[model samples]
Target: MKKLVLQFIYGVVVKAFLRIIVGVKFDNGKFLLNEKQFIIIANHNSHLDTMTIMASLPRQLIHKVRPVAAADHFGKTKFKEKLSNYFVNTLLIQRKRDKENPANDPIHKMVDALDKGFSLILFPEGTRGEPEVQQPLKPGVALVLLQRPEVKYVPAYMKGMGKAMPKEDSLIVPFNCQLVYGTPQIISHADVTPILEKMQHDFNALQEKLR
Candidate 1:
């Protein structure tokens, strides 16, 4: 169906296109296909970030990689919903929910996906911001780690994407960009406070590496 076609385009064609335009490079990219569960965390800046990150991975792992996207943004329209689900294979979650019940928490859905053995691509910054700028880490990622502390946390940093596809523009510019995959870290703490701090620190370290 359409999903298969999009996946094919993403895995084959689009991946090549991104490499050519952005000059995508990988460090520690071997982790992309390794036999271990990962919660891939990166800074969100451009719409291209998701695709570029996914494209860097091996083609066969495309279906196994699920980007945690904001439901309100990607689920607003039927076409977007379909495209998000099929093309990128995203796990869309509502950002706003009842706070009284942990049963209704959206983080549970992410935890469930992790338990199902699917690798996740999470932007802990919550919303797209200026590329290379340090946005505060959202607690959602820390919440997931608190639940599944054993999952490998991979930090990725991207640069020049804001120029390629800025938040104020819909049209993409052909600008050179780079994405660097950093060493994976683990969270063994039950408290999410320290975990959030570590998430911020790891992301910062990756950004420093990019500079």
Candidate 2:
């Protein structure tokens, strides 16, 4: 029943809003259909970033793809938590660590999701910064990759999402947005530094290509 609702939301509602209302154009979208579990990392700009990525995916995979979101923001209130969980099917993690409970870390939660065979949509920037500006990615993504060495990583860059729905605004404007997917690659490195560097490089290349 939950899967049916998610399919309806992503396949019909979100798809229509992104494709018709917002005019989203997807490049290399075929990569999103890969059968293997992987992580799709992208720049964070607006709330629409998650919805846009979700809508771009194939309807059958809606239940298999989970977006990693901040617990404080998306799961702060009971109503918001239910909406994000039941509607979006998000995997909410704490952005701030609890000093007493080491097990409550975000990286552990993310890796657990991957182990469960769900492809993740991650915003490495942690939070949405200024509109249209790329911020330095947090090392949490690199940490996750370190644990799941075999999982493929796909780079994605989104444009015009900020203008369509800026970080400060709740009302979405009808503007054309673009989402570009880069080739998926497995970064084999003993250290997180090299993994993070390669991830940033891939994201930069995708952003340049989008322009």
Candidate 3:
């Protein structure tokens, strides 16, 4: 019953909010494949990025996405934790800087989530940064891909989210934004550098497509 309610809120309420506030447009187009499971990586720009991406998806797909969020930021307060639980399927993980050589890597939690057959929404850039600013892809995403080599990888890019709600601001400014999904790719190489570079390139290309 709780899952059903949250799905309604996300697939309907949040979708409406995004349409009203940001004029969010999604161009899944040829990229929406038949694959049910994937590891989606996107460029992080603002708090709205994750919501925008999820809301942009078809309702069925939206419900299947489990966003990997930072625990320290989103789980700081009970209210925030409840809100996240009610709205999205979020897997909260600790920041790398918060613990050194911890017994359990947070990535393991992501692995568990994938093992259950849910698609992931990850920001390989790690944290929000200036829109269109180049940030190196973290190795954690690559490691996950290594572990789950059979999972499809999709690159999504958002444009205008930083301006809509800049990282420094709490108030949202009405702006038009686009979520572009690129073709799905399978990881064949053991080394992740080339794969990361290709994803970064695809993200940049998506950003350019919006301009």
Candidate 4:
């Protein structure tokens, strides 16, 4: 009952607030996927970026498409933690911390989620701010792709989100949101590095298109 109520609040009220107040709309949702092991590598510009991403996915997929949020940021406050766990279904991870393998607990948790048929929505830049222009990606995304060679890569570019909720602003600027899905690329075990580079290039291209 609690879960259902939370879902209603997030899926309906939150969606309406974003759409009605912020002028956000989701298109090309049919391009989004389920069933396959996939990674959604998106550009990070605003805090509200996740909503636009979630808006495009079907409800069932929304529950399963976990976002990889930074531990320090999301873990700083209890409110953020609870909200991420409940509304975003985020999979918070510590960055390059230990000698532990990538397949450690958090990675294993994600593997288990995917094993149960969930996908990931990750920002390869790791932090929210990239260059004013597009920037190079963090290796965490590459590591995940390398380790889980079967996962398909989908590059999604978002525009106007930085203006909507810029890093420096406390207030949000209402603007129409844009999200576009590019062709899916498959990276096998042997082609990890090149695949990652291609992923980076693809993301940059998509960002350029948004600009």
lDDT of 2: 0.86
lDDT of 1 by residue, 1-211 (tens): 6546656876678777877765655444656666588988998899989988887777667778899998888989989999788877889888865558755567988998998989899998889897667688878888888778788888888888888889878877777688888777788677878888877877778778777
lDDT, ranked from best to worst: 2, 1, 3, 4
The best candidate by lDDT is 2
Tens-place lDDT per residue, model 2, 103-203, is 78888888889988898999988899787688887888888888888988888889999999988999888887899888888887878788888889998
Ranking by TM-score: 2, 1, 3, 4
TM-scores for every predicted model:
0.90, 0.94, 0.89, 0.84
Please list the residue runs of candidate 2 whose C-alpha ends up more than 4 Å from where it truly belongs after superposition. 98-103
Q: Pairing residues by index, what is the TM-score of model 2?
A: 0.94
Residue 139 displacement in candidate 2 (angstroms): 0.6
Q: Candidate 2 has which clashing residue pairs, if any?
A: none
Collision pairs in model 4: none
Tens-place lDDT digits, model 3, residues 7-38? 67766887788777667876753344488689
* CA lDDT, candidate 1, residue 42: 90
TM-score of candidate 1 on Cα atoms, chains taken together: 0.90
lDDT-better candidate, 2 vs 3: 2
- Candidate 1 contains a number of clashing pairs equal to 0
